[model samples]
Structure formats: structure tokens, C-alpha cells
Target: MESTMNAFPVLETERLILRKVMKTDAASMLTYLSDKDVMEYYGLEPFKTEEEALSEVAWYDEIFTEGTGIRWGITLKGLDKVIGTCGFLNMVKQHSRSQIGYELDKQYWGKGIAREAMEAVLRYGFYEMKLHRIEALIEPPNTASIKLVERNGFMREGLLRDYEFNGKTFDDLYMYSLLRRDYKGELS
Candidate 1:
């Protein structure tokens, strides 16, 4: 894994900007993280307080500082408000792989904002980070997420039976991956 230790990278797409999450973005993070609809497949309960949201922002900073992962707060081109977040986590440098995760505000669902942000992140992971593979784990029932990954050139690998315990219960996940070769081929 190439380390992004010096400066956090900010990525931009035609309609979105993927920037570092800050303390000031806590309220905006709360807007979506606290919504039941947005958190439905996210495995965590909807946040009930601003403090919970702050902790999330702190996690984003922690991952970047520790060189374990990077998360970006998603915003529109001319706006400073964060509508969502997306990033790579569980990065294994030795293995040249990382897991991708993302969520959007309910209000922004269907606008392709997540897809736009994901494309930029994917490019960074494969090109800048020099990763060979990026993975996405989605709940079996998250059809929307399944579709998104498929559209982004990810291939379904297999099911991770009872892979995650979301506090109360264990849930199975469908593993999807995009290899560097596949990503490059898509561009061609």
C-alpha cells in the first residue's frame, strides 16, 4: 500500500467533491446517519445524538492518520455541505486490497451521487494507492448497493456466511470485488 501520510487527498468528480471529514461536518453527518432509512443496511443503529456523529467523524480522521484507511465526506461541486461519505477500510498493504463502504442521505438517494463519488474513490484506490483489488460487502437484501457495485465493474465473488454481527444479530454478506485489471479494462 502506498502511504498517503503526508497530505490527505481530495478527489473531485463532475458533480461531487470528496474531501476530508471535519468537526464542522458533524451536524451534516448526523442528518443522514441518524436517519433510519439510510442506516437500514449500514449495520449500525441510526445515531441518536450529535456526539455519536462526532465520533464517526473522529473515526474518519483516525483511519487516515493511522494509515489504515481513508474516508471522504461527499459534497456537491459548489456546496460545502456533506451529503454523504465513502471510502476504503480494512486495507491490507501486504495483500494490496481494501474494502469499500459508503452511505448517502435519504434525500440524495437516486441522484447517482454515491456512484459519482465511488468512481473517484475507485480511481484513487487503484491508481494512487496502487491497490490490486477493492472489495465491497453488502447485505444480501441491499439490492440497491448490489446494483451499484455491478455497474461499477465489480464482480460478485461469493457469500460470506454470517460474516458480520451487527450488535444484536449475525448477518450474511455478499462479497463483491473489482480488480485492477478489470478496472483498467473498463476504461478501455
Candidate 2:
């Protein structure tokens, strides 16, 4: 497979930019990671403060250093702050597979920002990273997120019961996947 190790590639859409996540982005990241409403469907609890966001950014850095995952801070064109993040989580190099994930600021909901970012990330994963399959596990009730992946040609695989525990309780997730053969680079 082609080497994506230690590589930080910047991807851009008409209205958004997917760039490497920097420690300096912690303050902007806090805006959404700390918002309960925005994180309701996330498997983990919302970040409690800027320190948490800083730690989260450090975690991201570690994953990148280990070549296990890569995340990009999603920023709107002309905006100085990140509105969200999207990237691979568990990447298996031997299998050419990875699990994709994203979280957006509530204020940017319904603007198709996530969709745009996902498209670029998917393209990078398939064409640039040479990944064979990219998967997403989303909360069952998150219709918006499900639709976003479906629109990108990700096929619904199955439900993973008790797939994740959000501290208080277990939750099910709908698994979705997109294969390299299925991607035609269409982002509409």
C-alpha cells in the first residue's frame, strides 16, 4: 500500500477546508466538543473544559504519530476557527480498512458541512491513502449522520447491539461501509 505515514494532507471543498489538527485549535475545538447537544450521539461524553479539548488534541497527535489514525479539523473558508473534526479512528493497515468518525458544532448543523468534509475525507481515504474499505458506526437514532454516509454511497451493513457504552448505558450503532470499488469520486 502507498505510505500515508506521518503525512498530513490538507483537503478542500468549495466551502470548507480539512486541515491537520493543531494544538492551537484546542480553544476552537472546545466550542463543539463541550456542547452536550452536539455530542449527544457521540459514544463518549462531551469535553468538560478547554483542558479536555487540549488532551483530546494530544490524543489525536499521538494517533498520527503512531500511524494508527488521522484527523482533520474542519474549518469554513475564511473562518479562523474549526467548526468540527472528521477522520479515521481504528485503521488496520493490513486490511486496508479504517473506521471513520465526525463531530460538528451544533451551530453549523443543517448546513451540509459534515457532508462536504466527509466527501473529501472519503476521497482521500480511497484514492490517496489507498484504503480498500472505510466504515462508520453511528448511533441508530442519528438519522442525519446516517443519511450523510448513505448519500456518499456507504452501504448499511448491520446493527451492532451494545456496541458502545457511554458511561451511563450501552448503545447500538448502525454499521455502514464504502468500498474502494464503489467510490466514483462523486461529491454532490
Candidate 3:
């Protein structure tokens, strides 16, 4: 039996095992979340300890317990290493839609891990949770993230001026979204 963060359901992809996060993943999770380049546009500060990472994992679990959203830690299949995380945030149940966010270790970025993880989460949202729309907001300077979101079939809706912060300065973000029909090729 698998205990998921959101308890929604677990998903697997060719290169990743999408599962509930455990306190045990703190060390590995810190490797990614603690990086300046990795968290720069994601609007998070670098976590310096397993304790910090573990606390995050605990908070991540609340989305499930509270019945609001779902999130997963991305683990490699063969190595069972936590490389990154992806999930829905600020879910509005009546709207049947939610915001999405994800970040991977800089080491994992170009190897297609981000896309694999994105695909897995999207499936979980649309199929298991019955969400009609899933969206991501990317800070403009993060070109790699922009490409990744595009590769996953999320269309750019528009730019939201000064959408977020990096603890110092505000940054603009481009809004992207994919509807269930868009995911299934029913939308053009």
C-alpha cells in the first residue's frame, strides 16, 4: 500500500516513480530545493538542512489531509532518488482547476526529467482528480522552465505583471494552461 502526499493516487512514468514524500527524502530533496539557480524563479529560498526539507515534506502532506490539492516527489525508478517535486496549489474545487508548480535539481533539468514529471502530474490531475484545467506561472527570465511548460502542451495565456517575488525584487510571469480537452488533443 502506498501513502500519498495527497492520498490521491500514485503514478509512474518511464523514468520516474511519482509517490508520496517521506521524511526520509529530506537529504535528497535538499539537494534540489537548496540550490539558488533551481529556486530562483520558483519563489523559494534554498533549504540548508534535512530538517528544513523534512518540514517542507510535512507541510506538503497537509494538502492531502486538508482535501485541497495533491503533490508528488519525483524519484528515479532504478536509483529511487528524489530529484524534484511537482504539484497543484491553490485549488478551487468548484472551478475544477488549479495552479501547478515544479522544480528539479539543476542536474536533472536537461535530461527530460521535468517533462516526464509534468506529464505524470497532469494525468493525475485530469484523470484521478477530475480537474478540467491545470496551469503554471513562470517567471520571465527562466527560459528553461518556459520551454519545459511548452513541451508539455500548456499554452501561454498572457503575462501577469509583477506576479511574484524572489525575496528582493518582483518578477513578471507568463501564464500557461492546458485544459483536459487540450491534453487529449480535442482543443486547438
Give me the candidate number with maximum lDDT. Answer: 1
TM-score of each: 0.96, 0.95, 0.90
| Model 1: per-residue Cα lDDT over 75-147, one tens digit each | 9989999999999999988899999999999999999999988998998888788899999999999999999
Native-to-model Cα distance after best TM-score fit, residue 38 in candidate 1, in Å:
0.5
- Relative to the true structure, how large is the alpha-carbon lDDT of every model? 0.91, 0.88, 0.81
lDDT of 2 by residue, 1-188 (tens): 44347568888899998998888899999989888888899877888888889898998888787778899999998996888999997899999999999999999999889988998999888877888999999898999999899999999999999989999999999999999999978642
Candidate ranking under TM-score, highest first, comes to 1, 2, 3
Clashes per candidate (backbone, < 3 Å)? 0, 0, 0
Candidate 1 lDDT score relative to the true structure: 0.91
Clashes of 2: 0
- Report the poorest 10 consecutive residues by lDDT, candidate 2: 1-10
